[model samples]
Target: MSSPASPTIPIDGPTMDALMALMRLIAAGVTDDDAINDALGGVLGADSDSPQPAGTSPVSSAALGRSPTGETPSVSPFDAVVPLPADVPDVTDTDDGGSVPTEATNTDGQPMGLSPLEFAVLRQNSHVVTGLLKAGASVDYIGGFSCTALCKCCYSFHKNVDLIRILLAAGANPDATTNNDTHSASCLIISVVKNNVEAVKALLEYGADVSYEWKGSNALAMALDFKKLDIAQLFENFEYRKAQKNRWERYQNQRRRDAEDREAKLDALRSRSAAPTGESPTPQPVDGRSTPTGRDETRSPSHAAGGGTGSPRSVRETAQLTENLGAMDWLVPLSDIEWGQQISAGAHGQVFRVTLKSTGDIVALKRFPCHDARSREGFRREVELLTKFRHENIVMFKGAVIDADVSAMLTELCTESLFDRLERTSAPIPWPVRLRWARDIAKGMTYLHTRTPAVVHRDLKSMNVLLDGSGTVKLCDFGIARLREHTFVMTQHIAGSPSWMAPEVLRGDDFGPASDVYSFGVVLWELLMRQVPWPNKNMAQLVGLVGFAGSTLELPDRAPEGCPPQFIDIIRSCFAKPEDRPSFRSLREQLDSLLVDVD
Candidate 1:
């Protein structure tokens, strides 16, 4: 026997009126709480006797088919009211227009099937949508055309990014799609089709999958078809960002492993040193080297095992060298050194004088504060590059100490920078010393530029050229250096001190060997004048004058009286166009000839 059909539950007059008012509010996009309450209060009859709050609605849960205690009813009262065009006929009236029956039933026994959340989103009412969400509305509820709230918002005639953000924040899937037979697409794809850039951006920010396909078309392809180059580029940037993040994670993991290995080696060395002398300790192998028991294998043979034929080093000296070598195979331990006064300080790091306790070897320690992972990687790269340099005029790299908070590189200590010497003395530097200093700087630059992939010292100034106690100048500071590709290298942003920077660098152009030559010319001027470049002008004015006005440093007629004409000629050539600037090799030879004439 067939079961009897269930009786249709009728929606009350006041409930139907309140639902209709809410639909109107949603249609008008009225998300304001006070306005919504006022609209709802008029339909549901505001109680003057109770005098509710301004933003509070007088409608009770009981009016929506719940018990007086406010418990949820077996069926939602909203299910009985469907949103339709105000001028449209009821579901019962089926003309040649052929409107089908909805799932909801009004007092006249008509079915209306729209979900409250879907209706709220369709009307672009964030307030009602939030209310529905609080009332346990399903964010992913499928309504007309099998479209979810998010999908509907994406395809709405009016761009409603705020409503879409609300749905997304409330757990609406960014990649949810309508269940269309002919063509099904995600909210992102729909947003692209609608040409709503803001909606597309919101969806992507909330983790929209660009690779999602709909009817053989994806968001990327749709974006390209619509000539939305920015959106397409956004997808490419997203992929690149993901790749960079993965690469950084891998680099961090490798650094952690390397640190652990170094610690393990240190621990083994400490244990062996503490062992008794009579008993022979077992040799432990590390990096394919079997470290001899009771002796530091990393130390030179002349100083290892026992004292050499010469005078034996003191216990402190022996411990200092041995501990440093064992702790960091490629670096020395800070414990074996004593730090003196700080030499200089900058945004990311500081330089200080340090003495190696074993040999009383004085060196300059450049300490880089590891504020983030990027800085740590930069510090490591700088150390690696410095270790490979072996030029006489270039600062000699001693070793490095890599710690969690800070990393440091040790190099031969110099007495003072060329800038300091010039600033401290009133008299001009001797012509021979000046010539020798220029030659030394040129030689160092030549060596760097002659590398397989030439290294351009992007920041070359008088301050970066150091003079040892014996007056020999060595080039230092590679913080902003770049390894040239072909004959030039480009940077996204300008770097280096403005007063000494090349005109091309100031104009944000590609840097080459000639860029360094321009900076060298400025340093030469500083040496000859015994004063800072652009002493009266500020950085902005200086950059504008040098970069745009084609201005060069003024040559004083009285000063540098005995200076060779070749010196002035070299400076002039350096400041010319990039193609015309003399290479460091040519400059060095010219300086060499000038030095011979001075002698």
Candidate 2:
């Protein structure tokens, strides 16, 4: 029998030598710019002054068969290429004598079969990935394996989620998949298989296709297979939320279109009616009230007060009237407000019981001090936010006055605050009433938290909770409330009352919905005890004790009598770490269940 032929190596000798030199440089930790340049120059047959080609390896020229001056190869003793598997194809020789792998070259002419983005992700170098992106590397470039940069990062065992995020933010396709003999696997599916929750979340937030499957196994199924209940729940919740958001967007778009069409039709009708006619049409007053014209009528006292047309004696009055009428839709003119006794006064402004002159409606008017920009801004923000609220448990926003000298917000008046109710009555509040109040506050908070972008009532206290005429609780005083965003808002100084503030807020840490929950616990304690929390201590003392001394409220041996043990437990849970606090939704459910038991 004839002897079997020897197996041929894929990589050649000179290429192997250059690769070894590069490896040696990496091992020596010689990352200095001058040192790397000089070392690469020597190995790659390039002088210091030679211009390096873009995306080409340092030693590619020498690996093929050329010198720095374009001379034909005179083999050096140092060129010893390592042998790859026989299945690996030989590097293609180029006109410039650079031997790049033929299989690695894509249709876009990318060498090594991978874009800079792919190489950066494979190396798990976020810095490199950023640099490549800044240099215009395609985020969705397909590599030799037909996998995108995002897909490769997801499939990577290292799980460099930061690199994946960089790729995604650069517009990488989250739903891009890799195909094999078995099935197609998307980035999300790969992440699920790897049990990478964060990576899966990132992909989902980027609108990844959740319904994608690999061999009939979807991401949710894969998560379940791996016993990742949290991941499965996340996937399910994401899908549900996405569908709801889509429906809401469609409904909003339809409403907007309908409103535009109606406006257009009304405009057309007005234009036709305004066209020329034989008789002049009666002029209607801009204010929608009948006005005397054509010099045939006398001016009324109200007209004189508002500066009738021919009067130079009332120019200022006319300007003022025009300003009041042309103000924002939500503005309540000063002329319409009949100020009553002052309800309260603070450093920034005063709250007064005011009646509307036009409708005789009683409301609470909060006036922000003039020349104080920050206070005015806070007042404006409160007005803007409260106008969006329409919940029974939330105080109703009536209107606002935004004059330079008088900036105020008007809201529905409540009979009494919870704090005043607790203080004025010596008798213990009934357990049922306390439970009802707690339920009401939780419902209000749940509504606030469920709103778009959510709302954090940073200042939650018995003083801020009001009782309407029918004893219905309504949350008020949103001066310091924050609209929750993706990132936490940092404060230079602490906000909120010390006794009712969360420990984190007292310590000047970032406050979130959980912080509000903590405050709600303190408020609940107040309701149950019918007394102010730490009434004996001042604000400074309270902050020192609760924030720095690590002291928390303690229930007396016979405290909160007639209340269920679970209610007390819920209060205690709120004082725990923020992460451990029950959400407003959970608290609502718990309170609801307690109410059922009471009934």
Candidate 3:
């Protein structure tokens, strides 16, 4: 607790550094200025006459009604400033229904000097505002004639506890009055509307007067008007006053219901305990089976059920190996597989259609069949991988369904594959568009390859790249992906699509990142030709074609016009000796330059 006589201290260097670092640490709450000042031997003692710090503009006393000495500026909030134009009314101060009113304007119809940063702070963007504050921005200075930071926060009805904490910790006066001298009692009321009880509690704890009134309206009355009974009761003896009494009725009812629930749970536990222990009440042993009777038999519900309650998921999942073979009929049907049309499948066992559903919403369903080892394992891995990722171009997992026989992963359905989109569309993709797609692909790959444990997408080719309705390319198919250092120890098997497989993968060289780059080269070639690479030749012929050193393939005359020479160069470089290939970062930079030139 702070002593009343201790002077308000300015932020110290260490405190300032912490406050600045707070922009990066969203959960750090607020920096302790007093503690930092105490540790620094009072260097942060309040400077009432201190000039504006470096990188900040001085508060112009003329704009405010007060002098430079921090005195009240004007009778009206707008007094020091020019009166608003006849067109821009003072609606912000109106008492019309409780809607949050927009800010009033000046006579010239221009809003006063509130910058976007100020608006962001007022709107509860604590993360962004903290960044501005750390950069030496001022929040204490009065604006719009005489409105303080607290007044702006109150007017906006911001609910961010972080923003509120930042303002208060930075010395914003909780009791500051508005231009109308309303003293911002209604601001606390607004917090209740936002369900920001913590902010209201913080304000009251900071000495904001709930008893203070304006136009016969006190904070308690404002709370009542907003129907925030819990907040209103906090101001007075909740049991004695009529409004408080009513508030307490609701609160007590809630508490009674909660207590009843707790007691019911306790009763259930007692009943179970009292009834158990006779022969351990284990499940009757199956024919010829020996039961493991005793406490171990009565494990938690999840332990007996296999998958725990609220477990994670993956883009892919596998089934356990022990489920009934007949149960397969109840889950994903083999007939649903549209052999040739569904060109791509997720590593986790999902399939999609190019056609839309009856509701016209395109959809994709990931299949998880129970008791299938591959599906269950894939599901776990997919859930683990997808949830941690968030990027604009990456595919989003919508939801999933878990049932006795099947676990279907849901994701956004893309209508076209990158291969099909390039070949079928009469309009050739512009150089800029191609470059953008290449960059997007690189970024997605970079995120996967550099993630902790590092994911290597063994299948990296055009067919695995899906195009949404907007033509944005998203990489899919993680079937061959493996976490670095996590050896499967299973028999060696061919993992990637044969056509796109690198030479090393066919020879089984423990597929690595460079192999993915090699496949990317084939994909680039396909994109340029707007057709499958080596269409006339079979897979065996293509493999044979790649064996020749220093061999280069030329695009047919029908290839898209105006393709960049640099893009072709990149593809060639990626397919060169693994050690000689440039990194994806270098490729992205080169693509970015090409995009800039074309744009």
Best by lDDT: 1
* 90 Cα displacement, candidate 2 (Å): 89
What is residue 106's positional error in candidate 1, in angstroms?
93
What would you estimate as the lDDT of candidate 3? Answer: 0.52
Model 2 lDDT tens row, 1-599: 01111222233344444434543443343445555444444444532223446754433332322121233443321221222222334333322333434234334443332322343354455654565466444566443434555765676532567877888899877887754213678888878777788888899889886666677666765776688867877765664444334435545666788789989988996887785757777765544445456732222112212423434423333333334234357766677878799987765478899999889999999887644445555666677788889999999989876543456789899858998888778866777788889999999999999988899988899988999998899998897788863222222233577688786665445679999999999988887677678876554444434543345787655545678878888888889889999998999899999888876
lDDT of 3 by residue, 1-599 (tens): 00011111133344333432332222232345543233223212222233556754222334333322366543221112222222322223222223332233345544543322243443344555554455444455443424555555655545456677787776666766555255444445456555566777777766665545656555555565677767755543321232223334545666788789989998996687564446554354322234454624222111213433323322112222112111222232222323225535544354755223323444566565435556565565554455556766667765444443345555677767787777767775676777788888887887877778778887787867888888887776554577753222221224666467665443323467887888887887876776666565433333323321122356444434567677778888887877887777777788888788878
Off by over 4 Å in 3: 1-350, 353-362, 368-371, 485-493, 536-560
| lDDT (0 to 1) per candidate | 0.66, 0.64, 0.52
- Candidate 3 versus truth, CA RMSD in Å, comes to 26.3
After TM-score superposition, the amount by which residue 424's alpha carbon in candidate 2 deviates from its true location, in angstroms, is: 2.7
The order of the candidates by lDDT, greatest first, is 1, 2, 3
Q: Let me know the TM-score candidate 2 reaches against the reference structure.
A: 0.46
lDDT of 1 by residue, 1-599 (tens): 01112233344456556666666666566778887666555444523333445764333332332121223543443433244446433333222233333333444544333555656654455788887666555576443325566775676432767888888888888887654223578888887777777788888789887767776667776676688867766654554444334435545666788789999998997886786768865565543456555775433222222323322333333333334334345566556668799998875489999888878998889998755545554565566668778998889988876443236789998868899898877765778889899999999999999998889988899989998889888998886677863221122123578788787665445668899999999988876778788776544444434544356787765446668877888888989988999999999999999999988
Error of 1 at 17 (Å): 76
Best by TM-score: 2
Please list all clashing residue pairs in model 2, or write none if there are none.
Answer: 13-81, 16-81, 16-82, 17-80, 104-113
**Which scores higher on TM-score, 2 or 3?**
2
